[model samples]
Structures are given as C-alpha cells and as structure tokens.
Target: MDHIKRPSLSGLTGKRHSSRDRSKDDAAKGKQKRADSPLIHGQQANGAPSPASRPAKAASTMSIVIESPPNIFFGTPTQSTGALFSGQLRIAVVEPEVTLQTFTMQLLATITARKPVAKDCPECAKKTTELFKWTFITDPKTLRAGDHSFPFSYLLPGHLPASTQGMLGNLEYHLDARATTRPTPSKGAEEITFRHPLPLSRALMPAPEKNSLRVFPPTNLTAHVTMSPTIYPIGESTVLMKLAGVTEKHEDHQQRWRLRKMSWRLEETEKMVSPACPRHAGKVGGEGRGIAHEDVRPLGQMELKEGWKSDFDDGNIEMEFRIRPSGHVRPLCDVDSPTGLSVTHSLVIELVVAEEWAWTKRPGVATPSGAARVLRAQFQVVVTERAGLGISWDEEQPPMYEDVPASPPLYPQSTAPERSTSTSHPHTAGSATPAVARAAAAMNGSGDMTPVVSAMGATQRPPMERRGVTTEYDGPPLYSPSVVPQAVPALNMGGLNDALPRDEDLEDIDLGESMRRPGPPSHRNSAS
Candidate 1:
C-alpha cells in the first residue's frame, strides 16, 4: 500500500510541473506576438529589459514664448523710420533636464513683392526681399528645467512698404523665430519654434489720378492739374493748376467773366476730439468730454500774376505752386475713432473777382485792398519722406503701371486700375474695358481730336507768370510717341482753327467738330 501511494504522489507532482510548463509556453507565445511593438523592443516575457535595446535619452521637453505690449500701433510711430517693432522672446525648458549644446534666436520679417508672372501663367506666384531681420545666440545656460528671456526692438526703414493683408502684389510684414537643440542623456534631440506678425499700418494715399476736375454747384471753376505722379516722392512736388471761367453770361462786364487774382496755399489742419472712452478726461477734472486742441497751419502761398494784369482775357488763369520749405504735408491717414482727432492737409485755391457769379464762396476771405471775390478749390495730397530709405526692385521688371508697356493701347494712363482709361482685354493684364480701347484708338488716329483746353500746356499757353519761386512744372498730354503735335495737324491749319482757341492737354475730350460755335466754351470737371 505504501509503495502504491508514493508512486501516485510522484505522478501527481509530475503532472503539476507539466501544467506549469504549458503556462510558461503560453506566456512566451504572447511575447512573440508583440515582438514588433515599440514598447516591447527589448522586453522579455517576464518584462525584463534587454541590454542591446537600452539606448540613450530616457525623456525630454522644450518650449518657447514671446512677450509684447498689450496693443500694437498700426499708425506711424515716433521713430527715425516711423516704424516701431518691439517685443521680448523667452526660451524655456519645461521637462526632463536639457543639456543645451547650441542655442539661437532669430527675428525675421518677410515682404511679398509679387509682380505678374508671364502674361499667360496666372498660376505662378513669387516673392522677393527680406524686409527686416535680426539673429543672436545665448550662452549655453544648462537650463536645469528653468527659463531664459531676451528683449528686441527695431525701427524698419521708412521706405519699407506698409503691412498689407492678403494683397498679393502689395506690401506685407510678418515675424519668425526658430531654435536648435542637441540631444542629451535625459533629453532627446529636439527644436523649439514660433512665428507671428507685428501689427502695423501706413497711410499711402495716392494723389488724384484724374488729369482734371470740374468744380461745380459750390463754385464756377473748371480746373486741371498735372502731377508727375500723384505719389510725390519726398514731398518734392510741383503742382501746375489751370482754372477756366465756366460761369454763365451776366449783365455786368466785371461780373460776367474775369479772373483777377488766383492764389494757392498749403493748409495743414490738426483736430482732436473727445475720445469715445474718456476715462482719463474725467480724472483730469473735465466733464466726461475730452480736452481738445485744433490748429490750421498755412505752409506757403503762390499767386498767378496773369489774372492781376492781363489786358485781353477770355477768363483762363494758370498757376504753378511748389511745396515750400516751411510747408508740411502730412501722410494721408484715415484713423479709426469715434472722437479721436487727426492732422490733415490740402491745397486750397482762392480765385478772386467772381463772387457774384460763384455759387459757393468763403465767408471771411476779404482783403483790405479791395472787394475780394474769392472762389475756392480744394484738393488733398499725400506726402512722405524718403530719408535714409533705399528702394528695392525686382530684376525682371519695374515696380509700376507706368513702367510697363501699354496694352490695348493703355500707355498714358498712369493712375490706379479704376482710373486707367485703358481697355480691359481678356488676354493681357494691363488692358481695360472695350469702350475705353475703342475710344482711345479712335482718338489716337484721328485729327478731329481737338483739345478741350482744361489747363493748356506750355506749347499752347505762354510761360506761367513767375513772381515768387521759379518752378519747372509743365502741364501734361505727356504722350510717348509725341501724339499732341501729330494728333492735331489742324493746329497748324489757318483761319477759324487758329483763332478757334488752340490749347494742348485735352485728356481725350470731344467738344465737337465746330469749336467756333462755342457759347460758354462748354467744360467738364472730372473728379476721380
């Protein structure tokens, strides 16, 4: 009985040991199934780490932060270039110890100056020039999971374009930051990066592109002005103005038609209103309404001498005005505010001896010398300085509408697209509307293109009477192939055509074939 029992127990023990071996085999199979997993790269069935798979860098972390003012000035700030870009950058180690081998911080701003790609390839896009940039490296501080910060400030050059949003071929500005890191025992290989844009706005009001404007309702004056470019450079501007008498016939000889004195003055006006939020005004012991300051500064004034002395006149006065050294032309700006004030500028012309005929008049423009009949004409102009600012240009092409060749014959229209009197052709980018092309073509080839005579050029009128400063400003109809002389061969023709009031600079106007039947010399004042 004892021998039988011993054998049975031994057999039982053997069976138990075999069951344990089966369980071990199952565990081993599970391990085999997960052999390709990242977590099991060097682990065995019992979760023991493999020596070969035990590499460096157990864990790591990194981050970057930038601090700046609560608000950004979208207007020209007080600086050399009038651009104020300021902020602070912070580098930090947020996790597992990092042994920084090399650390760097870069500040960069990009501007897109995309001109039209090949006329046929509209899909193509491109950019050029680095608007602003700065770079520096911090000494490896062995950031033991702490932080580091750096401050930066820059005044972009004045000539730098304004910050534009989504305007493909226009000015735009943005900021970028990048960092490089080395791998460490506790920190693996990594990099920290951040990018944003510095908010800014520039006032670039292009001068009126329309060659001439007719002042009506308020005043009886037909005026034409020619600017080399409405966008005058560095405040160096020469304004040539011509005024015609478009008033109706009156009973009195003096009241009917005569221009005595014509004067243009540069006016700078600054106004400040109660801010919508007058939080500070109330604290200053004022009625919640804010304190205000307003001032109008007259830069300089020029008068056309012809009106004062001309013997035989059919009521036409020409004047050339210059930006005086003392004159200040403010940058054109449209600030957003319910009550905040701003400084503005304009060219104001005061025509004398026409009060009885004029529909509009200035209340207190009387001179002690005589009965002043002042009719006024006002125009806004954009002014800026280019000191220490260098211009950037693309190698392939110039940076303007006038620089490019004419399309559908759109050569002389050197203004904005809306103002350009060119035809819009589907194939070419510069062409304009169908009606414009037809009109331009007809005017270009025909002799019937008589001068409408807004403000006649040098070839038509005598040299402008110079009293103060000598200005070289000439009137326009500035054609490329010399269209003025060639287009109107009738100017050389005799009889009524000669005495039919000859004048250059019509700007494509059809008065009629028989200018001889003129009553008031029908005039048009284009305001665009």
Candidate 2:
C-alpha cells in the first residue's frame, strides 16, 4: 500500500507544471478585472453626464483691430446741425497661409431699441429702427496672410440728428470688419468678425426764439423756466424759473398758497420714428414699435422758496435744482443723434392749492376735478462730464449758445491794436467797442442782473465775447460746447478751436522776449 502511494517521477513532474500554469492564469485574470472597473473613466458611481458629452466651440483663425483718431467722432464744426465722422481700421491675418474666401472692412451706424428681460423672447427682441446707415464700404477681396488697414471718413448731413442714447433705444455708431474662409481640411466655412462703438455728440438747437407753451385746463397756470446756461454743470444747477398765474387773487386778504409739490425729472424717451422694416413701421411713423419713456425719479427735491409761493404773476423763482448724473450712461446734452434716439430733459412743476381753499364755500363754483396744475419747461440740457472730470475750465472756455458769431469771418484781418500794458487789446477784432465794454453793455441791457443763459467762458472773460433736428424735431435739441464750451455751447457744439493759446502750451514758449520786443510804431500813426 505504501509503495502504491509513492507516485512515479513523471506523475510528480506533471503535477508541478499544472500548479505553475494555474498561478499565471490567476495573475492575468486579476489584471483584466482592474482595467474594467468604472474608476478608470470619469463616469460617476451615480448616473450623470460625462465630460466627453459636452458641446464644442467653433474654431477661428483671424483677428482685427481698430484705430480711431485722437478723438474719434463725426460732429458739427462750421454749422451746428451737420455732423462729421472719421476713424481708421487695422486688420491682421493671425493664422499662417490662410486663404480667405472674402474679407471686408466696414463702418456703420445703427439705432436699436432693445430691453434685456428676465428670459429672452426672440419676438420681443426684434423691435428696431435704422435712423441712417452711413456705410464706409471696402471692396471684397482675397487677403494674403499679413497685416492690412482701411481708412474711413464721413461728413454727415447737417440735418442729421446728433448721437443720442436712451432707455427706449440707442443711436449707436460702430466699426465692423469680417473675414470668411473655408477651413483647409474641414468641410464647412468659418468666419471671423469684429465690431466696436464710435463716439459722437450732437449739438441741441434751441427754439428759433424765446419759445413758451402753456397747458390749459390743468389749474390755469403759466410757466416758463430758464436755465442760465441751458448747459449746467453735472450736479447742482441754478434755475431761473418764471411761474405766472399759479394762484387766483381773493379780495379782503392776500391768500397764500403752498406748492403741493415742485419737482423736475429727466425723462428719457426713445421713439422708433423709423422702423427697421419699412412695412413693419406701419402708419404714423412706426406708431408704437419701440417707444420708451423712462421717468427718472428726482434724485433730490424742494418746495418753492417762500417769496415766489404767493400768486405768481411772472414771479421769478430762482432756485437751485440738483440732478444726479447717470451712472450707466453718459448724461448726454440734448442731441437728436442720427439714430432714432432723442435724449431730452423736462423740468416739471406741479402746483396745487389746498383742497379747502380751492373749493371755497361760494356755491355753484365748479372746482376742477384735477385741481393740481402740471407745467413742463422743456429745454435741452448739456449734461456733460467735463465739469466732473476736472477739464480745463480756466484756460479753455466752453461754448456759449446765447448768440451766434458771424461764420467764416476773416481772422486777424481786423485792424491791429496799440500795444498796452493790460494785454486787453480787445479780444475780438474789427469792432470799435472793446470786448469787455460790449460784454458789460450786453449784460446790463438784459434788464435784471441775473444771467438769462450762463456763459461757457472764464469768469473773467472780456464780456463782449459773450457769447435741429428731426428728420425735423418738435422740441429744443441738446449740444456740447468745448471752447473747449468752444463754439459747441453754440452749433450743436462743433468743438471750436482754441482761439487764444493755453498756459500749459505757453510754458514751452518764452514769451518774455516777444512781449518786450521793440515793437513797431502804432498803426494809427503809420497810417496818418
């Protein structure tokens, strides 16, 4: 039995070989199991979208750049109503050896009326109007891989409205460039496009004369408000308000009335005068496609000052009204920009007598239902940033719109003045009267000491210096004056040139020698 248990050598060798092969097979099975486990991939243990399932972005191979003049804009110069637009464009083919099917450089101005909503509705977003599309079109051509440029300039019609931005719509100008090419190996076409805004300002036009409109039935009132400089500083403004016929005279005693409320609001209105689609604009000039009225609440308020509160028969209420600067938008001057956009400000005055006094016990006297009188003094406001930006107020004078200077006048053609110590030789030329004398006379002639319109000049000006819309518009328009109020305070402020030199630039010039030169004999003596 023991001999039988002791197996043969060949049988023992076969058993050892079987054990080694089993060990190898176990190791291979373990490696395969580890590879099949879910941890190797990004798939979560719980069911969820994998990273590979996300969408892909379109590929691009070209770029563009725009370079505008030091001050890129199209605005009025000689005439207040016209506009001039000018700028430059630079484009570069970033990718190597890319053959483009078509490349274009263009400049366009479009006015759109859009409102961002909680959830975008494609239908509501379609309301828009193109006031005017002045396109600087370049020829379509194939471009070699290199840098390229296109220059553009536009002298818009003087009748063109100024640039305007409002809640209802925007009168925007932009420079756009695009390039299209079929990918080298890909099946479809790829495009590269770029767009940017252009800066422009419109000078608002005042009514032909000292215009006044009265609203009847709403408490039988008369109101006329004059903003000294129709263009006031950004923050606080001194308004010379003339409110007449506010209170009715009662015999026996002079009854005093209180202003229920006196306030002025900046009302922003954007109207789609012209619709994107002519037919869609419909009747009555795009009746209601994109009409927006944003009633800017009064940032600060006040009641009528004591003296002017009583029966105001042309009683002037000189009060300071403060308007807050818009944080989001440039509080532009009243300009009817080319796009169907008009930015305007209205000074609203609401006057109401106490209910008891209005409806007195005298029987059969029918007191009006709406007892409060609402009056609006609509005027163009140059809500400019120059004041806040600390721009040159001393050296460079702002434009004053009170009067128009003779256009295309010959400069330095007027007779020369005799050299004097005051350096006053009368800033203006040809006129017999000194500039200061003329300015003083004009100021005195206005009757009251208060200024009707503020001068956009230095406080120590020579005084004599003192000083359009719509497809056709119905109200006063806005303007920017830079004497740097240059002529702007005047023609939709065509940024007037600095007639006089600046102190900063003067720093570079040694005027001492020039000033002390042994001057020529007086022109008067020479002529004699």
TM-score of each: 0.32, 0.42
Q: What lDDT tens digits, residue by residue, belong to model 2 across residues 442-524?
A: 65573232332233222333312211222432222132121121222222212232344444566687667558556458953
Candidate 1 structure quality by residue, lDDT tens digits, 241-283: 6666633443433333356677777665655432212333343
For model 2, the superposed segments whose C-alpha errors exceed 4 Å read 1-67, 70-88, 94-96, 109-111, 115-124, 127-146, 156-166, 181-190, 203-224, 228-233, 242-266, 270-300, 304-343, 351-528
How accurate locally is residue 319 in candidate 1, as Cα lDDT from 0 to 100?
Answer: 62
Superposed Cα deviation of residue 494, candidate 2 (Å)? 65
Off by over 4 Å in 1: 1-208, 212-220, 226-234, 246-256, 273-292, 303-315, 325-341, 354-372, 387-528
The worst-scoring run of ten residues by lDDT in candidate 1 lies at 419-428
Each candidate's lDDT (Cα)? 0.47, 0.45
Which ten-residue region of model 2 has the weakest summed lDDT?
480-489
Candidate 2's TM-score = 0.42
